[model samples]
Target: MGRIIAVANQKGGVGKTTTAINLSACLAEKKKKVLTIDIDPQGNTTSGLGVDKNMVENTVYELFLEECALKDCIQPSVMENLEIIPSNINLSGAEIELISMENKEYLLKNNLDAIKNDYDFIIIDCPPSLNLLTVNAMVASDTVLVPIQCEYYALEGLSQLMHTIDLIKERLNPKLEIEGVVFTMYDARTNLSSQVVENVKENLNKKIYKTIIPRNVRLAEAPSYGMPVNMYDSRSAGAEAYRFLAEEVIEREDEDAWL
Candidate 1:
């Protein structure tokens, strides 16, 4: 079975979508088959992979509703080895709609199990909330990868997310584990960024990814052009950071297997 990782952060603007898009791209670039599931209603991950929302026929919304097969919803991205299950504004209503269903939290998990082995990794871009959608993602995933931005109030937001993960592990998915914590938008020129990293290491017992994503103009521009930073500007800081992040992820997998 493939490793299903949910790239989640309850706090928005923390580079959650950016990590989902670029990390998946880089992993695919390494010749590993990767699938990205855009569960966020914002659909940023969908667009970031050069998937046009206006033309999507099947999406995660339909998959949750069991309106289509998982294979029907999977769309190949611009990258050769990467695939995506696009999401759009239609997903915004899923939370309220799912509330009336039996075993709603397991809906995504059950759907994903059918095709888990098709790819080496399945990365989910979760919405920025602790609602049913996030619960479903947590329950479906083997691990949660959190992206913490290097800014004030970073640790404050992390506490709440950690608590939610604990609750999910306690009652929902006992197999759920924290994949790792990645620092994003870091500016080494400032003492604040350095301090934030130090604070995060002090507070969380999770492994902090060695590759810190620096604040880069290229990263912000890539999504507008419907491409990942690596394809947009392979030599850019953001691109290099994500590439290194992918290496760390692969290395961790090897380490885990050995353990």
Candidate 2:
């Protein structure tokens, strides 16, 4: 079965969607079949992969609200081994729509079961808040990967996210675990960036990825052109960093399987 990972951070502009897009793309480049599910109503992940939100027909909105099958919502991306379940503004109302349903948290988990084995990895880009959408993503995922920006107040929001994860493990999905914490938008020249990295590594309980995502202009610019950093600029620092991240993840999985 495919490993489901939710790339989530309640704090916005922390490179959550960027990591989701590039990581999925990078893994696919390594010949792993990957599926990226954009549950964020903003649909940055959908557009980042070159899919226009306005042109999308079967989106994640229908999967939750209309009880559509997972296969019906899947769309092929421009990348060779990558597929995506795109989302748009239509998913903004999913929180309210999901509230009255019974066992609402398990909706995504149950729905993804039938298609879980069709890929090597399923990555979910969650909305930037702890709502029903995020809860559903966590409930459906095996682990959650957090992207923390190396800026002021970075650690302040982490406690709340960890608390939510704990609650989900206890009440909804005990198998859920934190996959890792990655530092994003890191400027090595800044003392604040070094300080943030030190503080996070010293305080955060989860494994911190060795790959630190630099503040590269290419990373920011790739989305505007509707492409991942690797495809946009394979030689760029941002692309290399994400490629290293994918290797680290695969290595960790191998280690886990041995244990």
lDDT scores in order = 0.92, 0.92
Residue lDDT tens for model 1, 1-259: 6999999999989999999999999999999999999999989999999999768999999999889998899998989899999999999998887778899999989988888998899999999998888999999999999999999989876889999999999999999999999999999999999999998888788878888999999999999999999999999999999999998887876654211
Stretches of candidate 1 off by over 4 Å are 254-259
- Candidate 2 Cα outliers beyond 4 Å, as residue runs: 254-259
lDDT of 2 by residue, 185-255 (tens): 99988999999999888887678888899999999999999999999999999999999999877776664
Return the TM-score for candidate 1, rounded to 2 decimals. 0.97
Q: Would you list the clashing residue pairs of candidate 1?
A: none
Clashes (N, CA, C under 3 Å) per candidate: 0, 0
Question: Least accurate stretch of 10 residues (summed lDDT) in model 1?
Answer: 250-259
Each model's TM-score? 0.97, 0.96
